[model samples]
Target: MKDRGHVSTTQTLDLNDAGKIIDAGIAEAERIGNPSNIAGVDAGGCLLAFARMDDAWRGSVDIAISKAWTARAFDVETKALAKLAQPGADFYGIHASNDGKVMIFAGGVPIKEGETVIGAVGVSGGTGKQDQGVAEAAAQAFARG
Candidate 1:
């Protein structure tokens, strides 16, 4: 049999990784004295793990999920999309084009290993910067572990 030199295999984010991410987000949220919804999604934009803190905004659950989905699906931090989607920008109206599932604001970060994005973490219920802070904490913790 002729041996193939190499095969491409996609990296996956399992439950444990998701838990670590959630833990980090929780710690940050507690430190900030706020409750928020956190989301973890696989490279394919499917939810792997999720958590909504007590008293988190009831309206932000779907937004949190959409943030992670947007990050994983586009391999771009959702906050960055805000600028890209501005009028006259290359990706203008991109959010509306995605069936309104995309969230063009802070709180979504693509988790990457090397050059490959394995997953993403999203946070909601606080200010945009606050949400981003918690999400960044989650991504950093996941990367370290």
Candidate 2:
């Protein structure tokens, strides 16, 4: 144990920050007139906080969480994946290869602290653009606070 190499490190979100992200997402969803399902996840793609607005679709729960997880895991918005997964692209057929966990839709945004991506938030239960906007609002809230 005398010759230790460099150690790796990463930032992760705690419950407080995750809750903030969720709250902001909820507010955004309400403002947009589209009650949504929202989720927050740490750097390792573990769910930290979640919110399902009243009358939200029951099926959107998993999709929202998966959007956050996928964003954190890949450091890319879920919707952007759609472009990369198109036919003849490098990630073509990637959708079916991930056990159906991947969500290539607009509803995920990374939570960054400075240049480091600490976690992510995802939103669903509305149009893709609406979902993406809500997620972005959540991320901005986390950044500001």
Candidate 3:
């Protein structure tokens, strides 16, 4: 029997937290002089918040969201997945799975709490390094807060 005094439920990332992450990502993008599309996803890989900087590539919108979804879906950084998805690697051809939603590249970062992934952030519309930097900044800011 459940304890009446203790309510139990799985923790999930909320929109307020997601907004903070997105703001951090946007700030990083601006610092780097790169307009970008940023996306945040909940633990269940659902979109919680997003932002598109002015002059950002329109095509990157979907890419950013997919990157966030891919991160939360696999609980792995998309950049790391890129390496594994390389030719002849274990995850090779994985990009072809998930209905092409898997983005095996930089810019996706999973936010975790004690080994459990709570959510993720993704950025696009710049070089892989730039996107990675923004995503990392967002995750780091969240961790610090």
Q: Estimate, for each residue in 21-123, the C-alpha lDDT of model 3 and write its tens digit.
A: 9999998899999999999999999999999999999999999999999999999999999999999999999989989999999999999876879999989
**After superposition, candidate 3 runs with Cα above 4 Å error:** 1-8
lDDT of 2 by residue, 89-133 (tens): 878877675578788889988888888889999898988999999
**lDDT score, residue 99, model 3?**
95
Tens-digit lDDT track of model 1 for 1-145: 7769696689978888999999999999999988999999987889999999999999899999999999988999988987898899988888886789899999999999889999999999999999999999999998897
Please give me the total number of clashing residue pairs in predicted model 2. Answer: 0
| lDDT sort, best first | 3, 1, 2
Off by over 4 Å in 2: 1-5
Compare the candidates by lDDT and give the number of the best one.
3
Q: Which ten residues in a row are the worst by lDDT in model 2?
A: 1-10
Which pairs clash (backbone N, Cα, C closer than 3 Å) in model 1? none
Any runs in candidate 1 off by more than 4 Å, and if so which?
A: 1-7
